[model samples]
Target: MTDSESPSGRFRIAISAWEARMSLWIETPTVLDKTTGETLLSFKDGNWSLDAARWLSDSIVELTLRKYPGNHLPVNIIATLDCANRTARIGEKEVQFLAEVESALDNALTWRTVTPPPRAARSGFASAVRRFFFGK
Candidate 1:
């Protein structure tokens, strides 16, 4: 197992690997918030199959989340790599997904009590205009 921090130092990552069935099996890395000591994301009972063939060809890694803090985040994530092209894609909404993950982590660390938006505000602009015109 190896532990490291993201370049930004906002996240700590832990990874473990071993050999099995003639392949190198790597446990999906766990991600934690650096400041709060909270697990933002984790995976278990799953591993990446790294064989010589996979290294030379296309490959896919499926990850199952052991700890996911947000409703918006996925319990399962799929990452595909085009080894020939040296390109990769993980999940559908890459940017939005990362934003949601960070938001979930930030929410977990927030100390203040958050109040929901007022009902009128939640109803949307058209409803607010109607309420103003009808005095309802």
Candidate 2:
């Protein structure tokens, strides 16, 4: 953590875009992993995926592995986040989900970004992967 950041990640969540400062995170306490914070994904056309995955096997089997993640997660649109009220609204829907914020951070790292090393010369496998993907 930086000198300005709290050891326990006690800081406000501020994401500013389009000249707007939206607060999706209050002082709910979260450790900001700079690795994840360095990269962000968006719905821009540049990020579009049009091709379908080709099947490898002719037969499909269902696996009951209790090790997967949830699909219907509580993702707020960030219209307004009232920390005092312990509530947030998603677009026009004012849904009351995640009564406790503790559970949010437990898996927040999964949704965070990882910081990439500087564009300067990097050593080893990471640099190889970067060159392969980024054609640097």
Best by lDDT: 1
lDDT of 2 by residue, 1-136 (tens): 1122222333223222231126321111121224346211122212111111111222111111110122223332122233333343334445353243223322332343458877677779988898899986
Give per-residue CA lDDT, model 1, range 1-136, as digits (tens). 3565544565555665554446434445655566677665443334432111112221222223222222333333444333223233454433233324323333333233468877744377887898799966
Collision pairs in model 1: none
Model 1 Cα shift for residue 126 (angstroms):
85
**Could you list the CA RMSD of all candidates, in the order they appear?**
16.5, 21.5
Query: What's the lDDT for residue 1 in model 2?
Result: 12
TM-score of 1: 0.34
Please, what is the whole-model Cα lDDT of each candidate in the order they appear? Answer: 0.42, 0.29
TM-score of each: 0.34, 0.20
Q: Point out the worst 10-residue segment of candidate 2 by lDDT.
A: 59-68
Error of 2 at 119 (Å): 39
User: What does the lDDT read for residue 45 in candidate 1?
Assistant: 38
Off by over 4 Å in 2: 1-11, 14-76, 98-136
